[model samples]
Target: MKSTYQTKDFWAGCVYVAIGLAAILIAQDYKMGTAARMGAGYFPRVLSGLLMLIGLASILRAFLQPGERVERIQLRPMLLIVGSTLIFAASVRYLGTVIAVPLMGLLAASASRMFRITVPALVGLALLTAFCTIVFQMGLGVPLPILGSLFGG
Candidate 1:
């Protein structure tokens, strides 16, 4: 019989519960107002409460139902994805949305074992970059440049 502590659902539930509780605790410092006029902490507190409820349900389900054991973490894909995210954060200001988004997308996509650079992949990257540029830079008027200072924009 598989131990309850070894189940994937149990660990996932624990993670969710920890994060929810942390958020709830952090939110307590801010004032919570009525639903109609929510204060700074209201949304975080409400969302954290819901997250805690979901986590509790999952924890209960883990005890009631047999589940697969937690698998070993895949290092390559995890490192690639995390590295790409860090690169994106570090490069966004200098490279701007136009370059950084596609660069990050390419790096992230390469994390997949079946990843390949094809016409379709390139098109997807282009579309992603365009969407980010339009929505974040143009539409939302975020300060991110279309082309950054490095490109003399």
Candidate 2:
């Protein structure tokens, strides 16, 4: 008796399909060489194809099985997570990864109803920032400053 449109799986599948299709369409303009010698669009096209397959499977499963209903959207958490990403992107150049990463993590974690500013959490954030800094800035030799331009680094 439940409508398929109200199922969580259905909605999730729809989102995946939309994103996959969009990626595939956008990648169409780029060259797609052989797998051994991949072109600019090769990875995107391949990944998008996989995503579409998964979405189709999900859609099929939604129709064949009873699934949980799509619940009301949680705007607070959604907004917090999205806002954190945007803030990180906007601030990284000026504030650098050392500060921006933890700031973004804290903002995103606050989206959880049970989030607390414990010492452990702070330590974890610090470790994460350090790891990202080493991996991205040092290991990979990314040009992003550790201290950033805002601090005259």
RMSD of 2: 6.1
Candidate 2: Cα lDDT at 95:
97
Q: Which ranges of candidate 2 are over 4 A from the true structure?
A: 1-70
TM-score of each: 0.56, 0.56
Tens digit per residue, CA lDDT, model 2, 36-139: 99999999999999999999888888999959998899999999999999999899989989899999999999999899999999999999999998898899
Task: State which candidate has the highest TM-score.
Answer: 2
The local distance difference test score of model 2 is 0.93
- Expressed as tens digits, the lDDT of each residue in 55-76 for candidate 1 is 8888788899958889898999
The local lDDT score (0 to 100) that residue 15 gets in candidate 2 is 92
- Scored by CA lDDT, what does every candidate get? 0.89, 0.93
